[model samples]
Target: MTVTNADRESLRHGKITERPLRDKPGYPSWAIKLVMAVTGLIFALFVIGHMAGNLKLYMPAHDGVAALDEYGAFLRTMGAPLFPYESILWVIRIVLLVALVAHIHGAITLISRSGKSRGKFRRTNLMGGMDSAATRSMIVTGVIILLFLLFHLADLTLGLSPAAPETFEHGAVHANMIATFSRWPVVLLYVIANLALFLHLFHGIKLAASDLGITGRRWRVVFSWLAALVPLIVVAGNIIMPLSVLFGWVS
Candidate 1:
C-alpha cells in the first residue's frame, strides 16, 4: 500500500483530540451548574414559604397558635383520601433531600475544579466586592446551614433535641417556636444561622440567574437587586420571628 502526502495529512487531521482533564466524560460543568441552579431555586422557594409560615407567629396569641397549628395540620393532610396522610409532605421532603445532595455535590465539584485551575496564589478579590465574598463563602455558609437544618429538625420537627420544648405537641408550631426561641442561646444561634442563609441565598440567586442565561447586561442590575432583596426579605422575616419570641413580643 503506497501512502501519498495527502493521505498522511488526512490521517493526521483525523486523529482524536484530547480534551482538558477537567472536561473528561462525566457530569459536565454546565450540567453541574444547572443542577445547582435548579436545586437552589427550589430551596429559595422553600425558604420563602417557610418564612411566611413562620410569620404567623405575629398573630394574636390565641389566633396565632391556632392558625399555626392548623397550618401544620393542613400540610400533613395535604392529599388525604387520594393519598395517605403526610404523603405529600414526605414526597416534598424526599425531593428537597435529593436536591440538597445534588446541590452540595455540584458545589464541591465546582469549588475543587476552580481551586485546582486557579492555583493557590490567584487573587479571588478581582471577582467583585461583596458578591465575591458571598460567592467565596458559599461552601462555608452551606455547611453552616446544613448543620443548622439538622439541629432545627431535631429541635422542632422531631422534638429530639435537648433544647426542644419541655412539652411536645403534634400541631402546635407556634408554641414550639416560642419555646425554642425563648432561650437566649437558641435565639442567638438562629440569628447567626439566618445571617449565613442570607449570604448564601444572595449569591445563590445571582449565580442561578447567570447560569440560566438570564444575564442580559441591561437586566443585570435588576437581577442583582432581586438577588439582594429576596434573601434580605426572607432572612429579615425569619430573624423577626425569633427576635419577637426572645423579646416577648409574640408571647
Candidate 2:
C-alpha cells in the first residue's frame, strides 16, 4: 500500500528521520574494515613466505644464493600466467589498493568532521598534543613505511640494477634482492622501515581487534598483546634476514 503525502511527512518527522547507519559494517565503515582485514591477512602470508625464503640468507653464500635461486624459480613458475600466486597475489594487491583508498577516505572523512565539530586548535609540540604520543606518531611512522614500500617495489619488483645482476638477472628476481640487501644502506633503511612498521602494527592491530567485536574486558589485554607481538615477530624476521645478508653471518 502506497503512503499518502501526509503519512510520508509523519514518518519523516519520526522514526524515519533517524540517522542512517553509515557507521555499520558494509555500509562504509565496517566494509572498509573487512577489506582491511582480508588484505592484512594476505599481506601476512606474503611476509611469512618472504621470511622463509630469506632464511636462505642464513646459510653460506653459494648455498644461500643457490637456495634463493630455487625459491625465485619456484615463484616465477607459480606466478606465470595462471596459478595461485597469480590470482592470489595480484587480487590481494588490487583489493589492498581499494581497501587503502577506502580506509584513507573514511579516515579523512572522520577526521575532518571531528575537526569541524571541535574547531581548529594548536599544540606547540606533541607534549601538548591532545592524544597520546603514539597515536600522533602513528601518522608520521605510517608515512615512512608507505614510502619504503614504494621504494622496495621499485628496487625489487621493477628490477632496477642492484650493483650486481648478471644478464640472467633480467627475469631473475632473487638475484636482485640479494644484491640490494647486501648493501648496508639498504639494510639500514629496511631496519628503520621495520621500526615504523612495528609502530603502525602495534597501534593498528589492537585498533582492528577492538573494532571487530573482540573487546571482552578480560580478553582485550591478552588480544592486544598478541596483536602487538605477532607483527613484531613478522617484522623482526624481515629485518633480520636483510641484516644477516650484510653481516657475513649468512652471505
Candidate 3:
C-alpha cells in the first residue's frame, strides 16, 4: 500500500508537510539551505565589522589622515614582513567572493526548487507571520542589494567615473566618503540600499536560525529579538555614515 501525495495532503488537511525528501538528481534542499545559512552568517559578521570600521570616520584626523584612513591602511598592510602588503586583504576578498557565490547559488537553487514543489517541503511557520513580507521578498531584496554592492564597489573601491566622486582619491577613505556623500543623489542611493538590506537581514537571520535547527521553544522569543536587533543596529550604523557626511558633520 503506497501513500500517494494526494492521500498525504488529504490527511494533512491543506497544511504544508515535510514529506520524506525525494532523491532529486541535483543538489539536495538541505545542503542548499545549509550553504545559505553558513554563508549568511559569514556575511552578517562581515557587515557588522565593516560598519564598525566605517564608524571610525567620525574620529578626528591627525597629520592629514583620518582614523578611517589609518584603518584602511592597516587592513592593507596587515601581517606585513611575513606576508606581502595586501596579500591578507586579497585573501579576505577571495573568501568573501567565494562565500558570496555560494550564498547566491544556494538562494537561487532553493527558490527554483520551492517553486517546482509548490510548498511540498515547507515546514511549520516558525516566525508565526512576523516577517511574511521579508520572507516572500528575499530574492528580490537580494538582487537589489547585489546591484547596490556593485555600484558601491565602483564608487569607492574602483573609483570609477560618475559613480565615484569628482574628488575621488585612492587610499583617502575619509575624504572620498565625504566627497561622495556631499552629493544628494549618492546619499539617497545609500539610504535606499540600506532599507533593502534591513529587510533582507531581518528575515534572513531568522530563517538561517531555523535552517540551522536553533528553534528551541524556550529560546524562540530571545532569538526573534536578536534577529531584529542585529539588523537594526547594522542598518543604523551604516545609514548614519552617509547622512553624517551629507549634513556636514563628518567634514
Candidate 4:
C-alpha cells in the first residue's frame, strides 16, 4: 500500500463523514414531536369526555343524580359480554396513562435540550407578554395538573378522601361531586387547578398543531382559534360544575 498525501486526505475525509453517523442512534426529533402530539391529543380527548360527562350535574337533582349514576354505570358496563365489567374503562385508563407518560417524557427531553442549547444568558423579550408567559410556564402548569389529577383520583375515583361521601357508593357520582365540592377550600383548589389546566391545554394544543405540521400563514388563524376555543370549552365546562355547587345552583 503506497502512502501518499491523497490517501491520507481520503482517510481523513472518510472518518469525518462517519462521525455524524456514529453520533447517536435514537428517536429523531420528528418522532419525539409526533409522540408528543399524539399523546397530547389523546389526553385532550379524555379531558373533553370527562368534562362533558360532569356537565350532567346540571340536570335537576333527581334526574341529574340518576343520570350521572347511569353515566358512571355505562362506562363500567361498556363492551359487556365482549369484555368484563369495567374492562373498557380500564383499557381507556391504561391508554391514557401510557400517553401521559410518553407526553411528559417527550416534553421533559425537549425542554432539557432546549434549555441546554439556549444557555442561561439568553435575552428576554418584554413584548412576549402572555404568550411567552404561557409557553414558559407549561412545565409548571403541567406538574400542578398532575398533582391535582392524583388528588382528584384519591377524592373521587378511589373515594379515599376524608371529605368523601359517607358510603362512597360506586355509581353515586353526582352525590360524590357535590360532597367534595361543597367545601370552600376544595372549590378554591379546584378553581386554581383548573386555571392551570386551561393555560396548559391552550398552549399544548397550539404546540401540538405546529408539531403535526398544521402550521402556516393560512392555518395560523384557525389554529389560534382552535387552541383558544378547545381549552376554553373544556375549562369552562369543568369550572362550572364546582362553581354551580358552590353557588347552590346545582344542589
lDDT of each: 0.86, 0.65, 0.87, 0.82
Sum up the clashes in candidate 4: 0
Give one digit per residue, the lDDT tens place, for model 1 in 1-251: 56567655666897543445555737788999988999999999999999988776666546434677777888999988899999999999999999999999998888888788788777745778888889778889999999999989988899985958787665778778878988999899899999999999999988888898886887878878889999999999989888888888877
Clashes of 1: 0
| Full ranking by lDDT | 3, 1, 4, 2
- Which residue pairs clash in candidate 2? 26-31
Q: State the lDDT of candidate 4 residue by residue for 54-77, as single tens digits.
A: 887776556434677778888999
Order the candidates by TM-score, highest first — what do you get? Answer: 1, 3, 4, 2
Which residue pairs show collisions in model 4? Answer: none
Alpha carbon deviation, residue 199, candidate 4 (Å): 0.9
User: Which candidate gets the maximum lDDT versus the true structure?
Assistant: 3
Which ten-residue region of model 2 has the weakest summed lDDT? 162-171
lDDT for 175 (candidate 3): 82
Between prediction 1 and prediction 4, the one with superior TM-score is: 1
lDDT tens string, model 2, 125-152? 5554322554677668767977887778
The digit string of per-residue lDDT tens for model 3 on 83-188 reads: 9999999999999999999999888887777777775666556654648778877888899999999999999889999899888999998888888989999889
Model 3 RMSD in angstroms:
5.8
Stretches > 4 Å off in candidate 3: 1-23, 119-130
lDDT of 1 at 195: 93
TM-scores for every candidate against the unseen true structure: 0.87, 0.69, 0.86, 0.85
The candidate that achieves the highest TM-score relative to the unseen native structure: 1
